[model samples]
Target chain A: MPTLIRAEGLTKYYRRPRRYEGAFGGLRTLITRQYDEVRAVDGVDFTVSDGELVGYLGPNGAGKSTTIKMMTGVLVPTGGLIEVDGTAPWRDREKNAMHIGVVFGQRSQLWWDLPLVDSFTLLGKMYRMSEADYRRRLDGFIDLLDLGPFLDRPVRQLSLGQRMRGDLAAAMLHEPSILYLDEPTIGLDAVARDRMRDFIAEMNRESGTTIVLTTHDLVDVEALCNRVVFIDKGRVLYDGSVVDLKATYAPHRTLVVQLASGFTAARAAELLGPEVPGDVIADEGPTLRIRFEANRISAQEIISAVTSRCPVTDLSLVEPELEDVMRTLYGNRTIAV
Target chain B: MNAGQATCSDGPLRNLPAYLQIVRGRLRIAMTYRQNALFMLAVVILQIFILRKVWTALYGEAGVVNGVALADVLVYLTIANLQSWAMQDLAVGSYLYSLVREGRIAFDILRPAGFVPQMLAHLVGGTLSMVLFATAALPLVALVGTLGPPASSAAFGYWLLSLFFAFGISMLLNLIVGLGAFWTTEIGAFGMLFTLVSQFLAGALIPLYFFPDWLRTVAELLPFQATTFTPVAMYGGQLAGSEAVQAIGIQLLWIVLLAGAVRLIWSRALHRIVVQGG
Candidate 1:
């Protein structure tokens, strides 16, 4: 796939007036010429190809939204080269806007006082969409996203979930080739979140719409993104497959077993012998928790070895949580993965 | 996909229809609050009553003051007040300020249409609705005060042309003030100051004819007078023939200058946002 978005050494710096505190601070700040500089996005480089749903993952204040803003043509980079669909976004904003759809989770682009459908109609006109095309797309979105119930209701009156759905439909109504979703699932409930994820996945699958989603929710990344680009402190930390990220950051899997009354964890460990590579710990009464790397020793081998030696009432395998893996990644910036 | 692929050309003329739709949308939203229009009409009517009483009392036993007839002065005051009430749209400034404050300007920046054009459309749409409400108050205006025809057909034609320029000048001025939000982030004080200064100087509260020679000269020198006084005076026959044409010409010049200022300030504002992450 060809690269649809690219950033090379992209940087954005903000210079804010130095804020003072305590007595006479406001007066001093008013007259002061000094400014403090913040590097919002520092030397970031990444590429997103066509037809790829890449998760632009970051923690709070990680410059994820800043990067997205620059990509969406709302902000001009202070330094370095960035392009969307072969055009410098800030230089040609309207042209860039025509081929891309953007949704910021914190704000809705819909007109506040008008019925939800009115925003669509206005956007259709703004985008210069043909009447037939607009109607067909609107009907399809209404069916797919279940927007019919509140289509005529004012946008300000809709629930958060309903409004978010409306926003999603609005963004995609023009059928842009690329969609940038900044924290799209920020405040959604389980059912709404699931529906959102499903819709995003379907859009990527059916229309081949390249999506760059920035989210704190690991589930959204796990459910929709095949490739993930992790950034923190205004720099790209890791860019690769989610499975590989987990393997690199968190390699261990745990096998939990509940032994029969007569069997103890010690006895189970002894029976497994040194051939099976793993550590078995005594859990709550008559239970053993075995930790092992899948590459070094498979969970099946360990479970079979333990079951053959000692009678087990129940057993389960626990894979590492992506959230924990991300925590570890965010906690230690020095870990080169 | 074809819709997405449609090439967007940049220019006001090409996007006129889209901008008109935006204007229509804003007008519809403003009309949603029907009570607000009625309230405005009531306020204007009450204001007219007070003004008529004051002017009548002041004109006591004098059919004319400063060579201007009482009837013409009443007509001028009525039209001036109505124009002031109808075109009183600080929406552009307040809207820009709030959108910037809440960081919701990203939506504006992301539209295929230019931000300034969209905002101008909004300003016009809001003013159009107010003009509608003002039209509804016309009957009351006639009953409460003098509402006479223009001095002549020529005068009426010049007044119409001058009013168009007045609208342009006012909207552009509001836009310039609104762009201040990009720098200050709070335009409430600025907007209030603009309203007070423009309303007083534009002859909305008091006609330029009432001002002393020095004060009238000062008001005439400024663009505010072009927004209200020029059109009102022409309609009242206070300015006629060459004088009326010159006043309209002055309004056109102000529009040109104010439009240039708006463009310059708008570009700078965009630069500020781009650099500062607005």
Candidate 2:
């Protein structure tokens, strides 16, 4: 596999307020101002190859944004080396910027007042696009993103989903080989979120563009990503596939069954006791919940077994969302030490 | 290769304009919001009007203080208003803060091209915007100056040197200020510090000649005077020959030193930024 990005021993630190004291220890100290060092990105090493859609996952303040910033060359790393497309990013920013696109979910790169088309045009100029080539990309992105309705609307008038699509298009307008998106699907509705995931899937399959993104929405990871990297407190807790994350954390799925009225929790457990792949949660009133290993007992076999035992009014099967899995991964660690 | 050149070389910048296009694109952005842009223009004009009023009040009481005539003050003040726009050349806050917040600077940092040259691209765009607006504001100031008494030009050559030196100083000052974003929070404190020093020492409120001799000497040595006071003083026939040369020379020397300071600060700041999280 061709390596598109490689980072070695990357680290970043920030000064946190240590005390309200002084540096000179005179009038300054009496006022009480002091700062402590915070290591945001600490010695992380990873490589992303071409056409890889890597889901960079972490809890809040897990140095995810910091790591992305350094990788994108937005912030200079205090130590180690980061080479994107075989070049030092911090050394020659404009040249570096030309090759990559960045999207920040909390912020909009789209021009707020201008129509989407006009913003794209200005960005075209920023990327130095030829008129014909710009038109070509615009046409393709417009079609793929389903941006027909809001093309002429001012970016401010766009829905969050629309704005995100616009952002993704802008990032790709320069035909950057790599894209670093920090929370691309944030604040998006389910419909829009699904659309975004679909669009990303198509892009990865088509252009072979190398993408590294950090997102809070774990479904986004399951929907689009094949690989996942989880970070917590400046360290990588897990790096592999979504399959790996699920297998490692809470390796069971939940099945809730609603019976026709009179079913005791004990009797329900007793009926399905023979097929207990794992634990049974039986305290939801008329509903009986069972937890079982998916790899051990198939969901169909358990559901069928439950239906035969009790007159099943309703039954639903759910695996743990990537969100809960991440919570478990990061929540298990303590920051005080 | 006339039109086709844009196609063959259409690399990462197909979405963005190249080199000269960045300049034009910035100029377009500046003019896009007519109300906000004009509001800034009006604020600058309003400043000129207020300064003109105060200078008139002072010169009326004293005919000419320290060989500087009343009309000279009027013209010098008006010209200073026009020149103030040049401060964009070294805008410290925008340069540094933008990179930190957006993280777009990362793309720039990893490129094969020289970093400073690329940053200069954005700097060039900003300066062009300033120059365009300042040029438009000039005729209005000139028209108002005609309503006031005329000033002498005995220090014409020295005055020119002073203006040149002021440009150098302002640019260097901006570099110093912009560097603050590397080490500090958000840049509010840095902006306050530069604004306070520039306003008092650059003679924006009062001319340097109006101050006591000892204080005037000290202010002249500082970088702030190199921005406005030295230029304004020369316009009012304040210096000539060696004095003018020193004023210009000192400003250039400061520019070099400040540029060096910013670069050193930038390297260290970048390391701190990457190694330590903010």
Candidate 3:
């Protein structure tokens, strides 16, 4: 299989100053310059194929940015191998840059003072784009991003949403095959986030533009990603389908049962205990709620068994989401990556 | 994607147009304020007119000082001021330093635009401010000024050549400083020292003739003097006949040397560009 990106035994370490708190600490450390080493990205191996949209998730300070930097060839790894579009990214940067587009949520790639069209026109020259191709891609971006109305306005004057849209267009102007977006939808309102998600999904679908996204917004992953990689403390804990993740970590499928008989909470717990090692979440008069690992047994088996033994009136199976899965996987440090 | 032209042996040349495109985009942003351009023109004229009155007084005591006539000095000031106007933040080190400080330079590394060219485009964006101001100021100063003897065509030609060379050398020097951001923790010490040497050696403060003969000889050999002295001397008609022609040749040599130095520094600097700040 042809892979768009691959990493093997990737690790990144940084030496940083450890300044003591309080005034005059700077003066005290001025002569010595005391420092400590930090390992942001530890050894890990992963790969993403062309047309793959992967969710790269991690807790804050989990070395997400470090790994990203190594992938982008912004920082040479302290150890290991990284290849993007079949090239050693750091060793041959100028060649690699031609095939990738990057957008950072906190920093804009567009010229702040220039009108959107002016920025686009200049980008055409920067990338050595053919006039016809530049025009074609430009028209596509303007239409895709709905930038016609804002084309003439200076970027500094754009609203946050408008600027992000313009920035997205600017990032795509060069027609790069792979798009690396770091927190692309950060700080956006619900409507804007949804709009951004729709635009990204459309792009990935239409062009097969391989996308690797790192975001705090779970919705960004749910809306677009079929596969996700979970990282913590600079190590990859999980790399698989999103569906499998929910089925694995978030195993406790909720069974919201509409009870027919008015049974006491103690009586329900006793009855449910014999069938499964599950918790009785609630017993409100005639209603009963039970939970069990979806991975350990089939939902159908549990439902049929419960109905056969007890007077079960109604029940519904609920699929756990990424939020619940992440809580379970990361909540306890007992399991290490 | 072109099969016949697949890689570095071919594509960098193809990519050159992208750099030019970025510069054009910045130039458009510089054009928005017609009122500001007009306003800047008026202010430059007023400042130059006031300075002329001071020069007119100093000339009363002597026809010339150090062979620089009062009228010549005013012209020199105008050119020197323009040199300042033409200044571009030439350091790649500052960007690297800020990236290290903010830890954001990592983001730039992942993109296809190389750090150096990406930043060069940013520098060109700011050039608009100074270029606009300088362009507005120069013409008006010519209209109102007490006449120095007109610059000979050779002098004017050399002056234009020096302007181009000055830009190259200045960018080269600043680029070295910018690259310094990777190793040096503080830019102030080097910045102050570099500025002092540039001011005295480049002849921005006064003509190089006023320096001791030995010092002037040393300054002439160094590339720094070419930034200001070559242009001012040529524009002020300080050099004449073959001397003027030789000066242009020297300035071109300096430009070549500085550009070569910058290319060497860029290669070394890339190895040290630590972007994923802890």
Candidate 4:
């Protein structure tokens, strides 16, 4: 796949005016013209290939939205280079706009008073799409996003989920090659979130649309993204496959074992000596949980050791979740893998 | 490679149909405020009526004051009021400001169409709707008394031309003020100041001829006079021969100059533009 989006040494510094406290201080500050500079994005580098769904995950005020603004040409970058396709977004906004579609989850792009279909028609006209092309795309989206029920209703009256679907459909009406979605699934119910994730995955699979999604929802990243880019404090901490991320940062797995009647913790510990390499971390009411590195010991070895002394009833293995991995990665500010 | 580029690369001529469609949508939305439109039209008519009565009382039955006939003053007031309604596009500027303040200006920049032209088209549509509504309300007021037809067919025709450029100049001025939102949070004060200054100088209140020499010179120096007073004066036959030619020429020059200024301001605004909060 060819590289469709690229950012190298991307940086942005926001200069905010310093506010004064006292009544006379306001006037004095105006005369002094004091300002404070905050670095929103700092030397970030990344790329997205054609037909790729990349998740851009970051903490709050971590320059996620700032980078998106620069990429979409809404704000000029204070430093660094960014190219969507072959054009610099800020330098050549109109030309770059032709190839990209953007959706901001919190803000609506549809007209508040107009019907859903009217907004679509207006966008089609804005994009100069042919009637046949527009109709075909609208029809497909109407069915896919289930927007038929609210087609004629004013956008202001629709629920958040319904409005988001309408917005997603509207953004793709032009069928641009790339899509930038900032928190597309934010504030959605569980059902709606699942539906949205499925639709996004399908859009990438079927239409070959390169998607760069910024989201705080880890489920959205886990379900839809093949690659995850972890950013914190205006820098990229990790950028790799989702599976590789879990394998590296999240190496520990747990096993929950249920013992039969008359089982005792002393007996269980006595059977599981130092040879059975794993920790008997918890012992509560006829059950014992063991934690171990998956690469170090197999589940079979721990189960056999525990059952040798006490009657084992049932046991289940647990894998390390992405949430745990991400917590560790962000909290420590170090890449484990 | 060009398949994705086909929609937006057709150039301005080919995009005319799309722009017209946007204009139609805007016009429909504007027409939805029928009650407000009617109320505004009534206010303008009542304003002109009261002014006519005051001037008539001042003339003391002579029917001519300051070398201008009472009927001519009524005509100027009526046409100028209508032109003022037609140029009441301060909402578009405020809309631009809100979009910036709310950080939704992203949609404007991300769309394939250029931002300035899209806004200008929206302004044109809204202005046309206001003009039509105000024009339709004219006959009802004219039926009362004291108002007459334009001086001649040529003057009526030339007035339309001046009114068109007047709208252009007003839209550009409003846009310039709106772009000030990018630089400072005091855009509301600027907008109010702009309206007060423009209305006073444009002869919406008093005729430029009534102003003292220095005041009249100041009024003429600004483009506000060209928007309403110049067109109304031309329509009433007050500005004849070379005077009319110069008035229209000044209007054309202001349109060109202001349009250029808007372009420059818009470019700078986009460069340093900060969209606050999502």
Candidate 5:
């Protein structure tokens, strides 16, 4: 796959108005013309290849949205370079818009009072989609997203899950080369989120659409994205495979060992002995839970150590939760990417 | 892949069809809100009726006030109301303002469609819908009031031309005011102030000729007068031949200038688009 989207030192600095002290502060800020320069997106660089699903993750005010805005050409960068399919997004916005589809989760691009299909019709005209292509695409999305029950209803009348499904379908209706989704799964139920993740994965797999998703939902990242790009304080902290991110930030993995009936905490700890540096999390009768850093003690060694001494009935190894990894990454310490 | 062909690769000209689609959608929405349009028409007619009574008592059988005749003034007022209905797009300004405040303007900006033209088409569609409603309801109102025809077919032609340009100028002005949301959160305040000023200057509430000499000069200096006063005056024959042509020329100039101003202000506003509410 070739690089379809690229950014080098893309920056956006906002000159926010200064507020004064007192009841008249808001009013005074209007006339004072005082502004404070805030760097919303500092120098950040990344490249996404065609058909790759990359998650852009960050804490609140971490410049994730600013970067997405610049990528989508909603905001012109104060400095540095960005190219979507070889065209600078801000420099040639209309041309760049032609090749990309964007969905801002909290906002609906669909017309509020109009029927859902009417919005699609307008989008068809906007994207210049052929009538046959439009119908075919709409039918596919309707079937896949289960949007048939309320396609004729006004968007304002749909439930949040239904609205989100509608929004996703509308965003994909244009069939652009790149899709930028800012929190596409925000505020969705488990089933809806899973369904959305499935559709997003299908979009990339079947259509080869380059997916750049910014989401707070780690499940979305874990389920859909193969690569993760972590950003904080307007900087990229990490960018690599999701497994690598978990390995680098969160080393501990849990091995839940269910021993044969009749095992105590002392007995379980003794059975594992001094060879393994695993923390015995719990010893509930026959079930034993141990957590150990994967780098220090491999799961194979721990399983071997436990099974050789104790009667093992069942065993399962749990990977470090992506949420824990994200929490650790979002903390105040900077980790070199 | 057919990505390039599938998208809006035809360049900026594509805004034309997209704008037409938006207009169609907007017109449909306007139709859905028919009751609101009818209620507004009732308010405007009531206003016209009260003003007609006031003007009648003031003229007192002589049927002329200052230099304008009563019949001409009545025609001017009715036509002004209709022109005002056609040209006004307060809903667009409010919509734009809310979009700014809510940070949903990003969607509007991200599309391949040209932003200014898209917004203009939306307003034009809604205005057209409102105009259609007013036209349909006019006959019922005509039974209560009397209005004369335009001075001549040529005058009526000029009036139509003026009216189109006037609508352009009006939409542009409202857009400019809405763009002020970038600078301040008081967009609603600005919208109200703009409506008050435009209504008076455009002579939607009272004819510009009825204003004092200094006020009329002030009103004439602004673009609002072109939206209602110019078309209405031309229709009533108060402006004819060279004057009618000049009035239209002024409207055209305002359209060009206001369009330019909107473009300039819009570019600046985009720089300050703080996606509020995150």
Candidate 6:
């Protein structure tokens, strides 16, 4: 895939007038020449290729939204370079906007008072869509996202889930080559979130639309993104495949077993200790938890060793969660990617 | 992908239809508040009633005061009040300010349309809604005060042209004030100050003819008069022939100057856009 979005040492610094506190602070803040500068996005570099779904993950205030803003032409970077589809977003904003669709999860782009369909019609006109094409796309989205029931309802009258679906459909109506989703599933319920994730995946798969998603939802990243770019404190901490990230940061998987009558956790732990290369812990009554590196040892071997020696009635495997991987990464900043 | 790129061909004229659609959308939104519009119309009627009684008492049965007949003065004041109400409370500035403060301006910036043109369309839409109310108030003009034709058909033509220019100047000024949000998050104070000062100077509160000579001269030097006084004066024949044409010319000049200033300030504001919340 060709690289469609590129950022080289991108930086954004905000300068706010020094605000004083207490007695006459407001007056002092107005007159002060001194400014406190904040480096919102400092020296970040990354590239997103065509037809790729990459999760741009970060904690709160981690510059995820700032980087997305610069890419979408909403903000001019204070330093460095950014090019989207060969156009400098800030320089040729309208031109760049033609080839990109952006959805900010927190804000609805639909007109507040107009019916949902009217907003679609207006966006179609704004993008200069031919009538036939507009109808075709609208009908297609209405079917795909199940937006028919509330299509004529005013946006303000729709529930949060319904409004979010409308926003997603609106963003994709233009059929741009790239889509930027800023926390697209921020406030969605489980069912709505699944629908959103499925729609995002379908767009990338069927239309080959390159997507850059900024989200705090790890489940979204795991479900939709093939690759992940992790950032913290205004810099990229890790950039690679999601699988590799898990292997590197969180390699341990736990297998829990409930032994049948007359067997204790300690007895099972001792029985499995010599056969498997893992730390066996005697957990709650009659349960033994075994932790092992997935790459080094197979769960089958560990299970068999425990089942043969100990009378086990119930067993369950627990895979490492992306959330745990992130917690580890965020907790220990020194861990090399 | 290439099909989408075709829409980006750079031409201001090509995007006019799209901008008009935006105007239509905003107008539809403004129409949703029918109760608000009716309430405002009632307020305007009450204002016209009070002004008529006050001016009548002041005239003391005189046929004319200051070389202008009472009937003509009544028409001028009625029309001036209507125009003032129509042009006031432009949503462009306050709309932009709130969008910026709430960080919803990101959606506006993400569109394929130019920010300036979009705002211009919104201003026109908002003003059109107000014009609807103004049109409804026209029947009341005959009921409460005297109504007369313009000085002549030719003068009427000039007044129409002057009114168009007046709209342009007013909307551009509102847009310039809106763009101030890029530098300062809160523009409510500044917007209010601008509205009060401009309305007074534009002779919406009282005719420029009633101002002290020095103050009238001061009002004439500023652009506010171009918004209200110019069109009203032309309609009343207070400015006639070459004088009316010259006044219209001054309005056109102000539009050009204000438009240029909007462009300058907007370009600077674009680079300074800071997403407020995150």
- What would the DockQ be for model 6? 0.47
Candidate 3 DockQ, CA atoms = 0.34
Per-prediction share of native contacts kept = 0.49, 0.41, 0.47, 0.53, 0.62, 0.53
* lDDT (tens digit, per residue) of candidate 2 on B187-221: 66657666766767777767777889898888867
Model 6 segments more than 4 A misplaced: A266-279, A295-301, A304-309, A333-337, B1-11, B61-63
Q: For every candidate, how close is chain A to the native chain A in TM-score?
A: 0.93, 0.85, 0.90, 0.93, 0.90, 0.93
How many clashing residue pairs appear in each of the predictions shown?
A: 0, 50, 12, 0, 0, 0
Q: Model 1, range A74-116, lDDT digits (tens) per residue?
A: 8889999999988899999988888899888988888888999
Tell me, by DockQ, which candidate is best. 5
Give the Å shift of residue B165 in candidate 6: 1.3
Query: Where does model 3 exceed 4 Å of error?
Result: A18-24, A257-276, A282-288, A295-316, A334-337, B1-13, B33-60, B88-132, B143-151, B174-201, B211-224, B276-278
Candidate models: Cα lDDT each: 0.86, 0.72, 0.73, 0.82, 0.83, 0.87
Q: Tell me the tens digit of each residue's lDDT in model 2 across A1-337.
A: 8898888888877765554434565665446567678888788888888889999988788899888877776677878889888987766666778778888787766655567887677566556567788888999998988888899887888878889999899888888888888898889998988888887787778888788988988788888889988887777778888988888896789998887888766678878776667688888577788888888888888888888877878888887877778768767887665
Candidate 6, position B220, lDDT = 90
Candidate 3 residue-wise lDDT, A86-137, digit = tens: 7778887767777777777877766666777777776665566666777789
Q: Model 6: per-residue lDDT, tens digit, A1-337?
A: 7899999999999998899999999999989888988888999999999999999998888899999999999989999999998878988888888889999999888888899998998788788887778889999999999999999999999988999999999999999999999999988999999999999999999999999999988889989999999998789999999999999999999999888978889877776666688788897689888889999989988888887888989999998999989999789765433
Error of 5 at A220 (Å): 1.5
lDDT tens digits, residues A1-337, model 5? 7898899998889887898999988899878989888887889999999889999998888899889988888888899998888888877777787778888888988899899999998888787887678889999999999999999999889998999998988888878889999998888899888888998999999999999999999878888889988888788899999999989989999998887767765687776677778788665577788889999877888888888988889999998999999778766566533
In candidate 5, position A88 carries an lDDT of 82
Spell out the clash pairs found in candidate 1.
none
Model 6 iRMS (Å) reads 3.8
**Candidate 5 on B31-98: residue-level lDDT in tens?**
88888878888877887787778777878879667798887887777778766766666777778877
Docking class of 3: acceptable
Quality class of the docking in candidate 1, CAPRI style: acceptable
